[model samples]
Structure formats: structure tokens, C-alpha cells
Target: FPQRYAHSLFVLRYRTLALKELQVASRKGARNLCSVLVKTIAEQVWAMEHPQYTESRKEPVDGSMVGIQMGKTKVFLRSRAFQQLESLRNAKMIDAAILVQSRMRVFIARSIYICVCSSI
Candidate 1:
């Protein structure tokens, strides 16, 4: 289930590239397609899990940064920072919802057009 979910997310994010590869593979009967997909997913997951340690990531210049802060006993954020973070997250959610809705509408419209054309 997790793999399927991840694959769907990956394909959505890289729709053009994924579609091109899929078309080519379908036409050519690529034998290593599964290995390529597994490798790509593993690389993407690893990149997310272990972001490279750059100079900016090494330390924040200011003490009052607006992100997650970890302490010896607990993890916490300032109220203002938390509010800002929540708003940012909500914005991303809305954007993703909009994208999904637009895609579904396009799919439905295309299917309806095909049906009408085929009947004629």
C-alpha cells in the first residue's frame, strides 16, 4: 500500500517524464523497467530521508528561526512560528487539492469527448 501510494505521488509529480518513459517502455518492451522504477523510488526516498548537509543547513545564523527546534527533553516551536508553519502547510494542501481536482476534471472531459466522438 505504501509503495503504491509513493508510486502514485512520484508519477503525479513527474507526469510528463513518467508518461514518456511509460510510452517508450510499452513500445519497446523494456525488461528492466521494474528495476528502474524501484531504483528511482529508493533514490527519491533516500534523498528525502537524508538531505545533504550544506553550509546553510549546518547552523542557523539567528537564534529565532521559524522552524522545528529540538531540545534535550522535548521538541517544540514558538506559537508564532507554529502558526506560520501551519498556514504554510494548509496552503500546500490546498494547492495539491486543486491540482488533483483539475486533473480529474480533465480526465472526465476527455472521456466524455471520446465517447461522443466514438458514437458519431
Candidate 2:
């Protein structure tokens, strides 16, 4: 039981460290495919690779991505810097929604036209 408890504590610590690394990467303009290099011990590296502690299933709303690339002695964390305002993000999303709706309308109209021509 003690061994398991120690392992659990290590996992939590490593998870927190990973999150902090991602935050630092995002702040430091960690753009492109690969970014911040996080130094970790062997046990921490193992924890970072663990399925339960490694992957973040839900994406954060700020458009930054959390991805990890393990190296020989460091973990590379990739994330985008968040520099835009909330209003700007909302505007961009609204534009995207409009574009999608317009495309869908066009598709529906074309399908209806095809159906009518076939019937005639």
C-alpha cells in the first residue's frame, strides 16, 4: 500500500509539472511544431508517458494545443501563445459560423435543384 501511495503522489506531482511546463511554453511564444523543452528525471519522464497522466483530452478554449514530444533527456511541450482578445476570438468564430452556414445553404439548394430536375 505504501508503494502504491508513493507512486500516486509522484504521478500527481508530475502532472502538475507538465501543466506548468505547458503554461510556460504558451507564454514564451512556443510556436511551430516543437516548443518548450522540459527537463525531468527518469521517474518523471515515465509518469509523463503514462496514459492516465500524459494526454489532455479536452482542448482549452484559448486555442492553444498541449502536445508532448519526448526526447533523450527532455520533454518538448508544444503550445500556441494566447495574445488575442476575447472579442476578437468571438468575432472570428462568428465569421466561421457564417461561412459554414452559407456553404450548407448552397449545398442544400443544389441538392433540391438536382432532385427537381430528376423528377421533371
Best by lDDT: 1
> Across residues 15-99, which tens digit of lDDT does each residue of candidate 1 receive?
3323444555554433333323333333333333346733234432231333333333333445554454345446667888999
The per-model lDDT (C-alpha) reads 0.44, 0.40
Q: Worst ten-residue run, lDDT, model 2?
A: 79-88
Q: Evaluate model 1: give its TM-score.
A: 0.46
**Positional deviation of 21 in candidate 1, in angstroms?**
25
Instruction: Give the lDDT of residue 90 in candidate 2.
Output: 54
Task: Give candidate 2's error at residue 66 in angstroms.
Answer: 25
Write model 2 residue lDDT over 1-120, tens digit each, in one string: 111112223333333334556555544443311223223222243343455844553432221222333443333334221111223345556887999999999999999999999999
Model 2: runs farther than 4 Å from truth? 1-84
Report the number of the highest-TM-score candidate: 1
